[model samples]
Target: MTEFVLVPGLFTGQAVWRDTAGKLAAEGARVQVVDVGPVRDLEAHIARVVAAIDTIAEGQDIVLVGHDYGVYPAVGAADRRAHRVARIVYLDTGPVQDGAVALAAVPDQELRERLAEDGDMKGELPVPSREEWSRWGSTAGVSGEALDRLTAHASPQPLGTLLRPLRLTGAGDGLPTTGVLCAESGATIDTVRMLLRFGDPTMKALVRPDVTFFELPTGHWPMLSCPDELADVLLRAAAGEGTRLEAVGEEEAGEEEAGESGYLRPFLLDVPEIPRERRGAIDLYVPEGGHVSEGTESGEPRPAIVFVHGGPVPEDARPTPRDWPTLIGYARLAASRGAIGVTLDHRLHAVTAYPTAAEDVAAAVAEVRADPRVDADRIALWFFSGGGPLTAPWLAEAPPWLRCLAASYPIMAPLPNWGVNDSRFRPADVVAHGGTPPFVLIRVGREAPAVATTVAEFVGAAEAGGAPVEVIDVPGAPHAFEGLDHSDAARDAVGEAMGRVLGRLGLE
Candidate 1:
């Protein structure tokens, strides 16, 4: 049976499931991180979770679990799809509120708003206050690093959801409750306070009879706190072993499937240098059927190269983020060859900014080498346009994760103002977000001051420091000409260019 559907609250993404889902998986319960959106709000974000619940619970009992402000989406989803929903578990979340009372939660100077009737998070105004940053707010517990992620990628929500009335249909009729409260160090207390502070009259009017209240002695995010305990609770509910767990499913183990990978053998690598504290991560995106047999050379894991896609990405999708290059044909080419290619996100300013992007590359290389599916010493880092930052800092510091590195028309110099994700701010967000890879560089770009100067300076520093680095100007190539998805030459060249770097590193 499916264990539970856990939805992260505002400003959170699938990474929130990183720990919780890992725990649940160890226990034999099918756990999935409902993909909402890069943005945090109702309609778009909440609706995704609801739809996941509905799809999974069709004619079955479900324990709709939500954290913090995620309660509204959980409840709304359950209410709209009553026949399939069995119970809604609120993990340190507020109960459904209706009308102006819900709007009252928004502390506005001259006006008030609410999603009481419609149970919308996007539509409502949280009101500019420290509460949004304090423990009283849903996002209070996030680490500076995690919060930085939000600032880097989080989008603003719409206001309609806040004003909509939460009209419950028949779906929520028999929905039971399970409150996973976070109490340790006062986090749970604030959770409870917020529950009373924002819950609907119906929820606050009476202590829920069906609720199986439990508290964790941890911070706000239990997924990061007691993953094991949280998993057990979810399993109990999914298996109907708890006081309020939903009915068990008939399906047997492995009968359920996981979300298809964007590859056959996807990989995530995290590497960090001194004082960095090691949160940098990289992923080898694979589409279904992307890989075949392992490398033919005895037990070889096949040659791998970091595939750095070009330029500043859309607001919805950053340049080096997982979703950005997905639209381009870059990653697809690597997967087709049975090559374990890596795509990373790193920071660059004006672009993604400086140090933030550099940190990601440095960290990503360390991680890529550790992957069991990858040849530790055979990996190569590839880049194009503004891809200079990937290797510049790594070359400068040479924190020891590379076998080789490559670049093309990189906007090599450090940007003036990266703002929140500045080199002065944080660097990890950029490198991987911008496609950080491991190994020596294949630098390419116009020989103009815009590109040549920074690349030359960085490599000269690395080579002088005894780092293994190389550069190649693209003659007359424009800034990002060689990596454009629209050009077959760019497509063909990316792999061949990467192949040359790998060949030099003795991975061919």
Candidate 2:
């Protein structure tokens, strides 16, 4: 029989795992639920879990489990007793890098700020209100009674537990690990696989054979929302029955009929390349004649559509986003439609770099408008992917010169796990301010659930605010359909979206 030990996350007690623990005990497994609430420091928390491991019979390895913030100390304990551990299960949480603190890893940026505002390094953090719980993670499928019980037993998390760094000696590297993902909280095996394409070293580590994943359809606190299912997943995870993650190219090779790799794939339409001028971090594509309708000598300047590529793109991604086939294709397509096409390399290299990325884009726009070849009053900004959130400031208060905005399969709101402050970078909330220019959204049917949820929220918010939004729905396509999906619907959707943007740019 497998011996089991479980650690609960912030604001939670051992009673929160009562149902799941009982189920595990009923299955003939020796169960132990570590009470980390009494501890006010990380060392104490780790020591408590370590003490539980010591209680197991000699030579009998145990399966260790960590839920949410509790994973930090659980990992520490596992590191100290790796030889005595058979498996490590991560429930709705990912591994934090060495020297990282739990407070920085909190899913909600606004909540993180509020918790740290007191500047009390040694103080505890309070539990959020019931309505504010969504900021932590989605509360989908959680019962009212379960929530009340959770609140009743909630404890203020020790500041030391969150403020202290989780140091690892690399001793627990490559341990048999199971990741139990909560799909509603914006964590899924597919998202992990997607991040793998960016070649993030952290994501790359998950490809090990011993590392497996299981995704639950509910929210962050699955033990309360779906205790029976969570219990079963925990058992299966201990048995090593979850799906294994593959590295980027490895997944493609495993497929019998492999499609073109995502970024390398061709654009939806075939358009002739136009004259290109390479500026610093900015590329300008001019129309075929190299003249703005023979009125270049006069006061008439052509409209410019600046395409902002989406990222958190790897700093070392070859060809970069500006050089990607899709960006180049869009720029060239804009040129074909009588508009100066602009693409720039922004500094949105990480989720936290949004401010810098926004600054980079602002500087690029100012530079573009100053050029005599472009009309400053007729400028439009087109965004994609993660770049979607950057549209917030402009939507909040559009300048007279900013004619329109467009986003293709964009993430309108920050997902719960992004740690992005909700007060800013929320286009869904800002679009309702009504000082926005005409907006266009090219939505995909097969977008990732978390992304789709944000888009839906934006659409609903836009409708409520009476914002002028032209939504082009591609029911058969997926996110990044311009390069990934080659069907007629994708092609038509791209063409229609471009025409609408061109029209908004005063090019039609």
Candidate 3:
């Protein structure tokens, strides 16, 4: 029988894995919960885990399961016993980079310093209060009775574990690895992966080509909140099965091919030397089997849609530019309909607002148009939310190659709170310049009163200016409705908007 070794995260004991272990045991597999006693440092933790792994029967298949901070020690143990390890399953955490001081820096420095100054519990970090636990633990789907159990079992983490540096060799490089990502923290994980890809050689090992990634729709602690589902994921990881747990209503009869989803298959494109010391990048979602134009002239390239994501937030809001998951879903929708979909990151707000964002959009458009695979003359611009204002310049003097513009519940007017002061930031004013491209405005009928009012005013102004504008209202949907609800109304609204865009461009 295969042996499964379970490791708990920081400030926790073997009890955290009990629920998951019970489920695994019911599958007729041997489950061993390694108690990483009194966390002192990374070295001590690794020693304890290695000792547990050593106790397993000789020559039996061993799988090391690590959650959160426990991943480091688990990886270290796997490295030492590569010959005996079959797979390394990472739960809501990825492998640590070599020579890294900690998985991540503690956010509250004052609290960290205070804990160190107190020297309480012989230097162990204090167990957080009930409120603190609830605030931080809520995201992991822990609540009510579960929250009480978690707090009752909570222990002070060893400061050394967070302070110690880590090092790794290629000893376990050949081992099969699986990453079970928590859905709520998916964006954070993507940001981490982006950082790893740009630099940081040590962390790059966590993103091996052979590693199968799956996203579980839960918070950080799947064992506590979703034990059965977590057990199923672990089983599939061991057997080398599915990459993702099907979302609601996504269950189909047949198995889906690896990396093949109904959405766009993303490929990264870097935008270098952007203004204000900022860097830009894009995720291009190309159609499956390539862009094959239908009913178009022979040898002509397929139409393309450039998607500008919303956000003009403070530069330090996130480590990198935010890529909207909703925009990616739309891009996939575009690709499935045989159009090249491009989602780009531009200069953020505060640092370089207004004209700078417009400049970035122009640069992105130029880049896309230059691509030989795209039909430059048949292109559209899609601006969502905060990105609405950036489309002002395009509407004012749209290039001949630009066929139309599409905005979804966009911020057409400026927000003084965000320091948007320039007159050009208003979409209505820009459309007054005339010669505007055909526009398709998607409004959420049940949107905030202010947003609905702004969209209505803009529509009136655009029509008055003799601009060929079409407004499609998705009744009873809120802002970013596509993400909020995937009802038939949402799908149909999106489809109708795309249909209008393609029809205007003569691609339909």
Candidate 4:
């Protein structure tokens, strides 16, 4: 109903939106690219965007498209001017995350983080020189000269813009949203797949009938590679067209059904309620395509990688949006070697309390272990963030029936002390069953290092107790690592780590 306006992410300005804007306008859609930069804070940044959109809108419904960091301002703009804003076209940029989902979802979603972590008053980060930008886009026809011009013309973005939490209360309420993605940018793609992994509260909240979806074959900067296509997607969505995929299950698509791919077998389970716990369930993601291995003479199946995604969206309940990153972790990365990967929804939310989450994990392992194709003895635990408190103890005191164990950033130590995420602490039963499997811990520096710290503490305690342990650390990564969705390096590293762990556990 309202016209269409776009908000730019960090480092760039409305200049980047030129191509896309033209295409949308050519289609008879009223389009405006708000240059809310050269501001001091996110609040100010948003106000500027709103002021510009208000001027262009002049009293009409407006569809909004946000690219990268632009997502934050878009939310602010929508929130501030909800009546004039109709729908949103989220390009490459995923959803506006909740107040710092513990792991911070950095590095992978680096553009925004880097801007926030390393921004100047001029709205510049340690950007790859104009030459670098051109080289990256050269294959797609982007030139350094164009990039230089854009960068020079772009105004500085403030730090608070990236750090501020989004408040979409009255603004985003009842607004139809369209998530348009670019498949080529590794980070952007990873963000979509790893929606749960990277702590994307925005996508979780928008999964209802209100939000439509679309995918493009461009990189994070679609205005550069697939401008025409991106514009087309936004216009159609603005004019009221959405994807058929959204029509599937309205209410409970269930965690397992989220992000269901060819290599993944996601299924929901009505789990048993344990003492000290309320209603609970288990979501599982196991490598599916390959034949169930005919066990050795002992009649045992291959072990599995029990994965606990980062605690970003408490209501995610399943892997739908979360499994975007699993494409690499489950299908292309780990499964090819003959392994089983499982993702579970623990009692991470207050609404989904303690013993309940622990029970989900136990039941998931029990269920997956029962599978004839799996080698139950080689089972390993792979956890993202807050996933630790439940995982660490389970690794220490797993059932005798289980085998090897592994976890990354398993949160089991002191909170409020490590500058980590302890704000959304949901109570849970921590089972420290002794006599667990050989432990393998993989830590990519930036993503939840708590688990790594836990691993170190455990290693120290084990040393005193004479126990063996392994730890791997990745550099220049964030709390969510590649699972966070922006850094190709993090994605590739974590995928490799998962594969290596699975191989060692003999899941391979």
Tens-digit lDDT track for model 4 on 1-508? 4477788765677778888888878877777778674576667877877887768635576777776667777777887777777787776554554353211222233243444555453443344555444322222334556556665765544555655566656646667888775544322232344443333564446556667777665445678666788888887787667653343332536432343221223211111221111113333433434433334223335566666654434454444323434332442334434555555555555312434666767776777777776666667766655455555555545565455555555444423112222222211212222244555566656433323445456556545544434556666654443333345555555556655675566444
**lDDT tens string, model 3, 1-508?**
7789988876678777778899999997889888876657877888888888899989777889988777888888887878888889887764565676542423243454555456443366677776665323224566577667777887888877766666678687668888887754332233333234333343345555456666676666778888889998888888776443221122433211221221112222211211121124666666655434567543467788888866544444343332444566667667666777777777755313667888878888888888786888889998976688787878777788899899988878653112234666688887765678899989987554434545777888887888788888888775556645566777788889988887766767
Cand. 2 TM to true fold: 0.91
Candidate 3 regions off by >4 Å? 105-122, 134-140, 187-210, 244-508
Quantify all predictions' global Cα lDDT against the true fold: 0.48, 0.82, 0.67, 0.54
lDDT (0-100) at residue 8 of candidate 3?
A: 82
Candidate 2 ranges beyond 4 A from true positions = 26-28, 58-61, 110-121, 247-261, 289-300
Locate the minimum summed-lDDT window of 10 residues in model 1.
Answer: 268-277
**Candidate 1 per-residue lDDT over residues 116-160, each given as its tens digit:** 445554453332332343323333245666545444543343455
What TM-score does each of the candidates earn?
A: 0.38, 0.91, 0.53, 0.50
Candidate maximizing TM-score: 2
lDDT of 2 by residue, 275-385 (tens): 679999899997865433333433457899999988787776666778878888999998887788999999887787888999999999999999998988999999998
The 10-residue segment with the lowest total lDDT in model 2 = 254-263
Q: Judged by lDDT relative to the true structure, which candidate is superior, 1 or 3? A: 3
In model 2, pairs of residues that clash are: none
Q: What's the candidate order when arranged by decreasing TM-score?
A: 2, 3, 4, 1
* Model 1: residue 246 alpha-carbon error in angstroms: 20
